[model samples]
Target: MAETLRIALAQINPHVGDIRGNAERIRRARAEAARLGADLLVTPEFSIGGYPPEDLVLKPSFNADAAAAIEALAAETADGGPGVVLGGPWVAEGKRHNGLFVLDGGKIIARRAKHELPNYGVFDEKRVFEPGPAPGPVAFRGFRLGLMICEDWWFPTVSETLAESGAEVLISINGSPFEVGKAQLRIDLAVPRVVETGLGFVFLGQVCGQDELVFEGASFVLNPDRSLAVQMPLFEEAITLTEWTRRDGRLVCTPQKLAPIPSAEEQVYRAMMLGLRDYVNKNRFPGVVLGLSGGIDSAISAAVAADALGPDRVRAVMMPSPYTSRESLEDAAACAELLGIRYETIGIGPAMEAFGAMLAPAFGNRAPDITEENIQSRARGLTLMALSNKFGDMVLTTGNKSEMSVGYATLYGDMCGGYSVLKDIYKTLVFRLCRWRNAHVPAGSLGPAGPVMPERVITKPPSAELKPDQTDQDTLPPYEVLDAILEGLVEGERGVEALVAEGHDRATVLRVWRMLDRAEYKRRQAPPGVKIGPRAFGRDRRYPITNGYTNLIA
Candidate 1:
């Protein structure tokens, strides 16, 4: 006789180091599952201590705390309401492993370790965990259920092994972070496994933000025929109960409701919002403050701040100098008013004169150079820092990836801030995102109703406004050419010859390459920001600051 199993997939968010809080979260999910009459409650990978604890897992005390939390959760299962398939760190045979625990009747019945350790972009699992042997299915609710971790399902060996060992259904718990189009990629990767093993596939993932990573919980279930049965929403915590019944010796899940998948623009915007919101809230900051230049980059940064933390929580300061145009001041003021946030204007003329006089004693009467331009930027930076200190607000840097890529930004000047909102975005994308934000305000945004950013801000040429007639194109190549060259070099795909062959001027490409290589030290010192692309600065792309090897041809 065949049976039915109601497995509740909990897509939840867990902090990196909060073991006790994570356990509480697990308990809450279990209680909800009990009410839903679920036979089993499945959670994301590392639900006890959070994912990518980084070096925290190496600490003896942290692992001990994680172990204690798991035991406590196991003891709660005595109520006999719903069995739990939990993921956390486990120490066995004198080595640490990414382990999953199966709890039933007030005790941990079995522990399954992950077989594959991923070592690539954004994943350093091999450094912390020792791989376990290929695992078979664990008996749960009168059925042999194959329990696998995040990376195990990415490959074929683990699923194949479990199928050969008499598993009825495949359930994978994941802490997978959001990339541009990762949801479709996950479905594509799972379809083959489901077709080969003739097993129902359940991918239960976490929904949360951790440092530079944001996990969008678009969990889903697929029938053995490679058809989607259940689909959960992304970028949020959701509890989805899926039904499965054995039919003709093959497990098939009952098709349920499917949440609408977010568009590319929506997903990228939400990732930035969630990442910034968590970074500010988890660290316990009152609010955020930023310099509101009339340029496109600062405009977008201010919009994101207002969206993440409510309008009243954001403060915009317009620091204009003698070189600043009247249109810039008006544009900045309009943006602030439109966003319904606090705004103020302070002239940097006094600070500039003071700095110039103080440095005049050295008899530096030479023609004005880039040093003077840097002084204005430093003055604005000092002013922002002072305001941040007085108000207990974090200062948000407004520079984007295009500027950061080419050493175009001043060190300790525009770069002085607690966090950056557009650090990974390029200049070309900056304009596009501003248009997107104006056309549609995101779901949880606290910004204004109509266009928060003035139309002129998006249409005007971008500039630092440190000197008169200083457009970005005057100092560098056009944004279109620059961004294309950057994507090629940063993605590690095209070299100098390849770029030149792709209809790019050899001189322009080589100049951009040299600037990118020389600016590594500056990016190293810049503040952290949300990552919305395939490769970001911090963890995704790591280059030595003092490297002398140049890929550019003479």
Candidate 2:
């Protein structure tokens, strides 16, 4: 019987549906683990096919290919190297499962399926996978290693069952997505399991951007005494070997260096950078182009793109109209210069004039109102789309959550883009991130070290600049109030009376709620962006567009 074990945690990034590519990543990690003299190498959930394969796993061919990859990986373990714990889609007894397989000695030894299938918010695991029954520990090198997949460890029952079944150490493989404050939350959730079972715990999380989801990878270990033994870095790929020894009949993890947790601002910024970088590269877009309007939203959007994809791949265009202020033009050019990206000025005056002339006869003698303003916005959208078609750059939209929440944006205008970096970020947080980026460059940033935008851009009032003397405040309440109300309605899910009791005006709260409901259709068509908070639009928060339930006061 073995008294010691060395386990290597592989924090890797896997592309969804890229079975062979993912297999190669695992093999590479295993080779490193072998060099580190580890007994077993553990990877994240669905490391073979990527997590949330979302309906892609339903196809028979995909499952077959995944199975073939798993078999090939299993066969490679015959060389007396470290055993591998891999997760992927598996079909057994005419049922599909989120399966975790143990590969050693040129064969599959033990197989465990995920029991707790997450079905809320960003996860719909129950829609595609059949939950496995309560799992027991798998024997490895004389130690009974308790294994859980992702959500299984969230509840105490699964860990208790494994403990009752004579499990020694607990390990969980996860594809958990990142949200503000989630890294700490994982530790809070895992500490309880360790306390209940009195077993050391190892958590391995996937690190990569898959669609709108970005897994932060901050995988960690908790000793049997509920002390942190190791913490991997966030938002990057890493491989760390954790040593374990049986002390007093229980496995205990040796202490390792802990990576410092980043502040919330840095976490959100890195999430945006990683999310945009992967979306563009994985989708095979050559680059990104966005309108630099000298506003905080566009300015910060461009800054994030430049930092994420590098300045060379980001193109900034200044589209000026009759209402475009000279200060805006200068600020936009200054921002482009600071980021060192390709910059050009494109005047939309001609397009606006042409649209005006064409629609003049149809509205004979009707004084121009918002229709003229909308035409200007559509003209800019057309210009950006044209550039996108001419070159291969995807249009990056610059609308923040505040504007999108109140329907304050023009759909085909500023909302026109392939992706948004600020979609989940509220207006108030946008200002904070811009300041944060200026002061510190993130670890993997590709942009400049200094400020990415002019200081005035953050201080100046925000505007769409579609009409004369137009500020965002012209149509909406102050951002501080709007953002507070939105936090209550969107994130807190508070009722109107509750918000009013908290000192918000009753009428303003109801007005914001109405605007939020009315904007659902626009949000439905908006592009996917990095999800930084819990209630990001699209999958996280779903509301019926056509609803009759209004919170009316008597």
Candidate 1: list runs displaced more than 4 Å: none
Q: Pick the candidate with the highest lDDT.
A: 2
lDDT of 1 by residue, 210-272 (tens): 888888889999999899999999887888888888887667899987898888878887788
Clashing pairs in 2: none
For residue 370, give model 2's deviation from the true position in Å: 1.3
lDDT of 2 by residue, 37-113 (tens): 99999999999999879999889999999999999999999999999999999899999999999999998899999
The TM-score of predicted model 1 comes to: 0.97
List clash counts for every candidate, in order. 0, 0
TM per candidate? 0.97, 0.99
